[model samples]
Target: MSHAPTHVTCSDVSFEWPDGTPVLDGFHWAVGPGRTGLIGLNGCGKSTLLKLVAGELRPTTGQISVAGSIGYLPQDVTLATGARVDEVLGIRATRAALHAIEAGEATEANFAALGDDWDVEERALATLDQLGLAGIDLDRTVGELSGGEGVLLRLAALLLARPDVLLLDEPTNNLDLRARRRLYAAVASWTGVMVLVSHDRELLDRVDQIADLRDGEVRWYGGNFADYEDMLAGEQEAAERMVRVAEGDVQRQKRELAEAQVKLARRKRYGQKMYENKREPKIVMGARKRAAQESAGKHRIMHAEKLTEARERLDQAVEAVRDDAEIRIDLPATQVPPGRRVLTATDLRLAHGAAVAGVWEVRGPERIALVGGNGSGKTTLLRTIAGLVPPTSGEALTHVPTRYLPQRLDVLDDESTVAENVARFAPHATNNVIRARLAHFLFRGARADRAAGTLSGGERFRAALAALLLAEPAPQLLMLDEPTNNLDLASVRQLTDALESYEGALLVASHDVPFLESIGITRWLLLDGELRSTTAEEVRESRWED
Candidate 1:
């Protein structure tokens, strides 16, 4: 993967939104042959850089060049609901042309359309299968497929295009475990110039190198995500040591400056005494006074300059240390007793009559991982349990106070500030208390006053998560569906840290097994047309299949 040559170049590129929000400024990046993982914080230009490289969005200034054909898969793929699978795969025309030629009515245009690509249908189906999209028939509409399947279908289209350069943005965002494996395999097999932007740690670990896009510049780490982390850890440790050394220098300079001032004061006093006592000739005394004064002034200036330089060095050294703050949540109200009944469901069935069968229950603070394949109604089940919708023929009852954070994250009122949103959730709590809790989530002071709508993806997720968890009356049962969908690595870590502090029952429906494990999942349940208990190992091995 690391053996390929450079295939892309961006020279002095700059981009910003129409509202003049700057994303990139004079950014220059070169895409070499091999897989490169582009990663950064949520608001950073990872996605935007991918777009610029793919020519989907032109740079506001400068130029970008790609050596060959490009195939791009965007983060948020919007498929035409009525469009057929084959149509979305971009082979409908070729298929139709091939069929026409087979029907003995081969027109010139039909033959031209099918030129050299007679096996397009076979290739399309093969690519779809490669991405774990085999069961989906060509006639099936986009609306029929699950969210994960739709993403895979888009990827299949890109693969079918067979471009020299491939750009994928969060390709594994909605994929199930099995689907993720398939995608990972595809990524590993990719040998061309591939620039992938994702927060999926597993996917990033497969890259040849890491392209960290932060503050509009790309820093290359010559290895996968794990290598980048190791290198960064070393760099941070060294930076911290430098900061300590710099701090000592600043303090020493300050002390020397203070001592110099004392000496100058004493000299001034001695000079006054010499003049008052008339200890020498008037000219000699006057000359000595002037010389002493000049020396004192020079000494003061030199000491002051030294202190300023030391402080400046200290500031630069401090800047080298990255601030990777983790969320610290302590909600005593969310705690539940070990023997308490948190949730109970009897003869559970979905509104669509999909397979949600038998008793579904959560006792005490059980952290359950609701695992299943794509389109298995996990979201619907979670929503049903949360009382967002009524079950078709069963009842889901929460014995304890409950809250749900849906995938759409519409819980936050966009017009309100973060503080206002939290206030809405925790109305009984005082503003000071609410803000104090928010500070743990890294929203401090004026940041708490920013409107939710203006927040970046990670910030919005944090706000929504904060609001859901901090709801009034203290939720004892928390349901989250695809909570890690758009979170960056830091946000994901913060979410994990916050979950560690949660004492409530958790039912998180996510394909993120590593994340689920990190949060200490006590039980794993596979959801299909029916629900049944499963072990973590089985859940992983079978892809949550029955």
Candidate 2:
């Protein structure tokens, strides 16, 4: 019998960027042979930690020890412009293997040099089949592959490496629903120690443990995403208690300092009278002066040093115990009237250049999730609805106002300013109003004047949202295409909060289960040959935490 390896360990770890902002501090964790979901908002150092564990980055302090070989697949895809798909996979450990094979040096040393064993190429082919790349020519250039297809191909190649530990960063971001389901199932059944960072709540629920990174600290929770949610409530309550206790101590110290000052002043006044009176005895006056001096000296020392230290401590305690700190940005009001059936589509079908067709039927005021496997036409349906693409057959009716926020914020003019983008959407709105609305979304003053192209993904999303709300009649029918992509955790939360309150029909096509859940999606349309209504059970049962 063999035991599972204790894969990765980090002790007394801390990290900081060049600007001196701390990302992680005093973080310690031990990952064994199991699935671990690393959960955190964007830029909380989730990806940074993954890179550190993969040995791609060095920690500013402390030690990281890995038990064996590790494979990491980043959320973003990196493709060599002119390289072939099969060529990319072969290059991974093949140069030496091929050299040995070509040199007629067929030995155990050569075979082991390629990987742990000789069948590396065979394993790669099988992995390629698993990713739906079996029949395709492996020698095709990567530049010829579609964006979505390339992502899958690279992922398959990475999986073939058969590493002891796998670090996946938002692995499901660009995948369709079917592909996502398959990926989720694969992750849940994998034997190695798998650490994944994802915003999808469904994925989080399948993991054995969840490590929530927040405020430069890791809060370990046993069980799945649902368990972590319950634990989070308790943690928030405890943090509040700490804040209350610190505040009470602060008040008590203020009172003590006031009382001490009064006593010191009285002693000084009495001593002066005794020293000035000619009839007073020399011994009494001398004693009075000495007592006064000692009292004043002691009071000064206590008030300046000890009392000051107490106050400083109180401040630190209060700072450490923040309870309700979250993203709370004010967005511009759309105030669009809820009219009858802003959008309606029935018996709708879509295809990818006459290849794969998707089924769909959606009604207004109904929150519908278009779900299917990879190449299932989720985007095709969205494009058809947005009028970017014409449906092959079926009727799509728009009764009232409508607006769309695409998955790619390409509608934005990169060369334009943030204010200019808003103005373009609502040409009638005055400059002052546009600026005010932009400020509400946390784009204030000089920041609003910055070029739109230079803004971070989160900022760009916020700006586009601002532009959308500024549209005339403020579309009651809002369509979002993967709106949460590239947004930070705080920004995602803010976006969710905004959508939750919007009193309009929402039609969103997204793989982000948590974001969907947050906004309360009721109906689901599975993109098969035709639209099929999905119950909550179907979704809950099939959706696994990554």
Candidate 3:
């Protein structure tokens, strides 16, 4: 497989946006027959590189060669509302021509359209079944499917093409646990050269190798995500050791330079005293003083050069260490007493017709994980608790202030800057206060001044999170729906770090089991037609049924 004639090759490629913002410069890459996981921070061009390889976007300067046909499944899958499943699969015309020929209307046009695929329908159905879409009707419209189903449908279409090279970009973004499992199975069974860009840790754990895209370059790592982490941990340890050694060398150089200067000053003072006391002749003393002064100048220059070299080495050492800043801020005002009721839903029935027949009370700073499949009213439940949706039967009450972060992250005004958005949330806070808080979210100075609309996916998430957490009332109760959907691993880690300092009650609805576990969830409630208490193991083992 290593010598499979390079299924895809990108040589000296350069890509830039229309406004001259560079994404990749002089990049080079090649992939053979195997599964490769592409990972990086947000805005690092993982998706853009996939687009270039799939021919959706062309590189401004270099050449990309493909050995055969290519198939691509984009991050956001959108199909025409009126188009049928078969049409989206690219086999509608072929199926029609085959049917016509079988019905005794074997015209030259029908025969030409049929081509060589005599079992097109069967192949399409098989591909759909392989992706867990067995029961889906080929005649159904694309608009009739749920978001997760739509993503799977797009993957099904790609599989039907049977291309030599395949690319998937965040294929599991909207998928639930079961759907993600199906997609994972598909990825494991891929035979041709495949490259996938995703933040899904479970999915990435199945790849043959990892290609870390950072600073416009790809660094290859053998084995899966777990192996990559182990390897990276070793490298970081070595880098940190080097940094410490370099720091010690710099301090030693400074001390030696200071001692030399002090000794030279003492010698000059003694010479001046001897001259004043007339211990030697005036001409001889003058000559000795001049020689001493020249020698001191040379020694000072040598020490200064040594110190400069040591400082340079220290700078290089620091650069070798990865200094990815994390979000660290205290939310002291958000604290709730152990007995204080944060939220209560008593016989609540949502305005959307989903009902919770029992009373549910959240006390203190409890972390709740709301688990459910797609279209299961998890968002509605959170919205109801936050008072965005009114209950039809009973009340959903919060004793303290509450904030809801929707899945789309529409909490902030797109036209406003990050600091301005935070100010909008906390009208009483001063400009300096807002800027200081924004810095904790990794948006320092001018970065906090950029409009929310221009921020990348991860930056926008951080801004929205900052706005919510730093509000005037301080969000004693926070509700988040799928907060980790499109965030890269680094951003997810930052979110986890930020939440670590929050003392408020948390109610997050997400399919990310590892994230939920990391946040110290005290309760797990499964949302179907009713609110049912569950556990982490149960959530992991349970599968969605059709």
Candidate 4:
């Protein structure tokens, strides 16, 4: 497909928090007319950078020039009280232009204002329709929409604007499996330049490019997340070699400089001290002085220059791969013997309102992935397992203890501190013990005391997961519902590593195919009206990139 040339060009940008801590340092990034996945570890300024690109936040230094109009769906948006999906779309300027005709406000001036061809109404509806949001009434209030619906409404508004660039920040955070698929499909169909910040491995895989941000810089990887991982591994190995070489050079230079210093010292000492008593020629003394000065100056210059060069080379090498500095905590979790049939269901069915029901039966340590297009009922099955909903007319039983991580990090208490939340969830543990445990999860000292509500999405998820692990005896059956929704690459890796080492059964319902595979998922139960066993080969095919 021939594509238009759309891009977001930023040059010499720098940003610092109000408190003066540097967040971004002379950052330069470029995104072109294709889906570019923004990958970074948690707290790495990915969201902040995305905001700057979206023009929501101005750069503290330098200029950001976007080639065309912009559409931004931020990671967080609180719908007005009692507002409905329809109302949110209506707030968009393009939608207003379309609505003007119905109210007889589409005057000659309005037509001329749209430029030569006019027909602004048609264009507006077409844009909305492309996102599968057309024909929705504008009067509906935003407060009545479901979380997933609210997300789609915001997306619809952005797309209807026919933006030259689209910036979506953590777009899949609150979406269920079905909604996520829909969102992905919508993104896939979008033709303009797109930059999205998300922890969703599935979404990252689908994009054309992956920009892995660490500290304040970007490393462009031309492929899906898996490909990026492979490249990153190679880069890391190369960087290590460079660091070793630089270290050796520095050592060699130090030895040479030391030798030079010794030689100069010996030469000076060998010279007779003919200050007043010895009959030494003045010309000879002057020659000696000149020789010593030249030799010392050469040694000093070489040593200083070599030292400066070595440090720069070493720093460059270190910085090249430092983006992956996130600790990969690969320690094994405490084991719990799995009971027979972790969860069982027969002819189970569930649905919300007019949406069709989803049915399935889950048993064993299936490592199941509820695969389906967006709007499918992957989350419903998880909720059913959690006993949040009763099946329409079927039998279901869970024989082992099941812990659920909701898609929205809902396990965390907004008002309570991280330590408090962990302690509350773990009643048997004392305060000191709980604090120590929280520290293991990277919530230490002042961080542990901070309110859970104020923590970033990744932090909140980690805190919740830490709390879950602290459960007495560790859950025999763990259920993670879209667990990668808001996680950055580091958090994702850490969580995956922990889960891989977990001894208990895992039933993760996620779109993160690479993550599931990395942790050794052997089987899957594709959610639909019927259950299907998926092998590794099948799972590979189910990857978002495929």
Candidate 5:
């Protein structure tokens, strides 16, 4: 595909927060044409860089330049409550002007406002339809839309602008499967200078290239996310080999130095013995001893320098190998017996009007995936199972202890420290015990002391997970809603690893199919007006239409 001629450039950019913590330092990046996936671990400033390029943020030093107009969709998008859809799309004024002109009240101001956009209303509707918002009325209030639909509406607005450069940050975080497909199609069709910061594997796969941001520097890769992973694996393997070689060289140098010292000591002893035996004149013996001492000093210095160089090489080689941490913990207490019933719901009807008209039971350590579109009552159903919401009819019961990790992660207290939050759940655990277990969740030392309000997105998620999993009585049934919503790829992997150690039944509601498959989901249930048995293949192929 031929891309348009447009450039997004950053020259010697440096950014820092008010606390003097630096994010980007002397960063230089220039992207043109094709889509570029900007990726890094959480809190690595990928989103900050995009904000700078979009003019939402200013660089502490240097400048950002765009050769053409730009459009940016932020990670969290919220519209005004009273704003109409067309107003959100930024075409309301033009649409109104066109209507006025058609009504024979063609004023000079109306023509000026219309400009070349006489067909603005048609184009706006078309863009909305393309983004899976065809059923959305342009005159409808923004408050009437679901969260996922709101995100799409904002993207549709950006599309209506037809900017040469487009930036998206975690655009698919709230989207369901069908909405995600629409987004994927839109991304695949982009033919401009586009930069995206997302952990969505499918979305990253559609990009033309990948730009990795680490340690305040950007490294370019030639292809999409999968290609980037392959390249990274090869680099890590080579780095590991280099580390091994350097370690061996260091050991050999140390051994050679030790042998040299021993030989020097032996020579000194022989020289002293000869002098004591009066084998030569005293003055000649003393001169010979002085020369030997000088030679020994030179040899020692040379060996020491070589050892230092070798050790430095080893350190550099180790640094080249990435040390991304993984979560590893044992949850033996959460195990459930094979014949035990974990949860049961009978003819339940939720406050949201979604019905579970038949008796359903979750037994043993089954992993259930709840799949559905936005507003299809996935979260409500999870809440209903968690006992947070009472069913309007029938009964929902859990025989085992249950824990729910909500979509908003409101279980954590912002004012409390991470350790304090965990302590709230596991009051009987000692401080040392809690910290020891939190280390497995990647919170160690000072990290555990940090306040919950100050954590990054990934850190906050980890803190919440730690608090929930380490709670008193040990929850035998764990339920999570959209657990991977804003997590980075590394955090997502860590989450998978954490869940691998969990021995309890899992009832998770999410649109992340890959994540669901990774954790070994044993059953799939589709939630529309009722929960029904389904398969992963069917879920992947199905589309929800209004």
Candidate 6:
């Protein structure tokens, strides 16, 4: 499909916080027509770059230029719950004008507002339906919609504007599987310039190309996320090969230099012996001595230069290879014996609805996926199961110790350091033990001393996960709610690694299907007013209309 050409250019842009925390320095990135997935590790300035382009934040040192109109959807969209859908869609005045004209009270002001388009409402409804929001009352208040619906509503507003450029930051973070598929369709149908920032693998796979932003620079790769991975793998393989070659060259240079020094020493001894025996005239002997010394100096300099060049090549080769640190924590204490009952729910009636059909039980190390539409009580159900809130009618119980990591990541104390937070969970463990375990989470030394409130989103996630998993007595039944929301793709992998080592019954409430699959969920349950058994296949195909 052909698309209108739009350009977003960042030239020598640099931005730093007021406290002198550097984010981007001399960063240069550019994107034109077609969807571009802006990706990198967490804390790599992906969102900051998008904000700068959207004019929400200004570059400290350089300039950003865009050649077309822009529509920006931020990560956390805040809307007034009391506002009407028409008001949020920015069509209230236009609707009012249409009404006045129909009432035979059309004035010049009303005509100006109405313009030439008489099918605006019809078009709005079509747009809503295209985004899987069909039949939604345009006059309904924002509070009536679910969280996922609210996000889509905001997107619908942007679609109505029909801007030349679109930027969406973590657009699918709050969306469930069905909602995500609808969003994916919308993105796929976009025929204009789009800069999408997200860690959602399925979403990234739809982009035309991938622009990896790292160390304040962008490395472009043609095609989608899978293509980018293939190209990167090839590059890494070549880099490792070059590193081996450089190492061999360095060793060879060192050996050659040593051999040259040994030969020079032997010549010096022979010359001294010849001088003592008066084998030649004194002038000839002095001439031979000067030539020998000059030759030795030149040889030494040449070998030194060769060695330096080899080492430099090695350094460059090493930098080309990525050494992503994986999270590895031993959780032997969390192990559960087969047939051991980990948790049970008896006639559980969530605060949102009626009592469930039967007694729910999780035994052994069963990993369960709790999923449903927004406002379907996924988070609320998990919270109730964790004992944070009481059920409306029945009870939920856990025989083993449990830990719940909420979507907000509120496990850490804002005032305390990362180490202190972990220590809070493991009160009986020594400082040395806590710090050592934090290192596995990539929080080492002074990093462990940083206050939880001061950490970046990624750092804060690591700190919270460490604290929860390493808590005293080791939680044998772990429950997580939207655990991968704030993480980057790499961090998600690390999370998978950490969970792989866990040997307990796990109940995760998340919309990330790939991550759910990666962690090896043994069961799936859909919680829409009531929880029911489901399969991974059914979960992917199931649709829950808001």
The candidate that wins on lDDT is 5
Winner on lDDT between 2 and 4 is: 2
State which candidate, 1 or 6, has the greater TM-score.
1
Please give, for residues 1-546, the per-residue lDDT of candidate 3 as tens digits. Answer: 233454889999999999999999999999888899999999999999999999999999999999878889999988888889999899999999999999999999998999999999999999888877888898999889888888898888888887888899999898888888788899999888999998888899999999999888999999999999999989889889988988898899899999999999999999989998998899999999999999999999999998899889889888777766799998899998897988878899877777787778999999999988888889989888877878888998788999999989999899999999999999999999999999999999899999999998999999999999999989999989999989998999999999999999999999888889999999998888888888888888754334
Which of 3 and 4 is the better model by TM-score?
3
Residue 328 lDDT, candidate 5, scale 0-100: 89
Better of 5 and 6 by lDDT: 5
Q: Write the per-residue lDDT of candidate 1 for residues 197-239, one digit (tens) a residue.
A: 8889889999999988876788899999999999999999999
What do the candidate models score in CA lDDT, each in turn?
Answer: 0.88, 0.73, 0.90, 0.72, 0.92, 0.90
Candidate 6: stretches off by over 4 Å: 1-4, 268-286, 544-546
TM-score rank order: 5, 1, 6, 3, 2, 4
Per-candidate TM equals 0.95, 0.74, 0.94, 0.69, 0.97, 0.95
User: What are the clashing pairs of model 4?
Assistant: 82-143, 83-141, 83-142, 83-143, 84-141, 84-142, 84-143, 178-374, 178-375
In the range 1-546, model 5's lDDT, one tens digit per residue, is: 124468988999999999998999999999999999999889999999999999988999988999889999999998998999999999899989999999998899999999999788889899999998999988999999999999999999998898899999999998989999999999999888899998899899999999998888888999999999999999999999999999999999999999999999999999999999999999999999999999999999999999999999999999999878999899999999887999999999998989887899999999999999889998988898888898899889999989999989999999999999999999999999999999999899999999999998899999999999999989999999999988989999999999999999999999988889899999999998888988999778654333
How well does candidate 4 match the true structure in TM-score terms? 0.69
Evaluate residue 245 in candidate 2 and report its C-alpha lDDT on the 0 to 100 scale. Answer: 73
lDDT of 6 by residue, 1-546 (tens): 224467999999999988999999998878899999999988889999889999999999999999889999999998999999988888988999999999997799999999986888998899899888886898999999888889999999999988889999999989978789889999999988999999999999999999998777899999999999999999989999999999999999999989989998999999999989988999999999999999989999999999999999999989888877899889999999999999888998888773565798999999999988777888888888888988888888899999999989998899999999999999999999999999999998999999999997877888888998999889999899998997888888889999999999999998888899999999998887678888888777765433
Compared with the true structure, the alpha-carbon lDDT of candidate 3 equals 0.90
Query: What is the Å distance of residue 312 in model 4 from its true position?
Result: 8.0
> Measured by TM-score, how close is model 6 to the native structure?
0.95
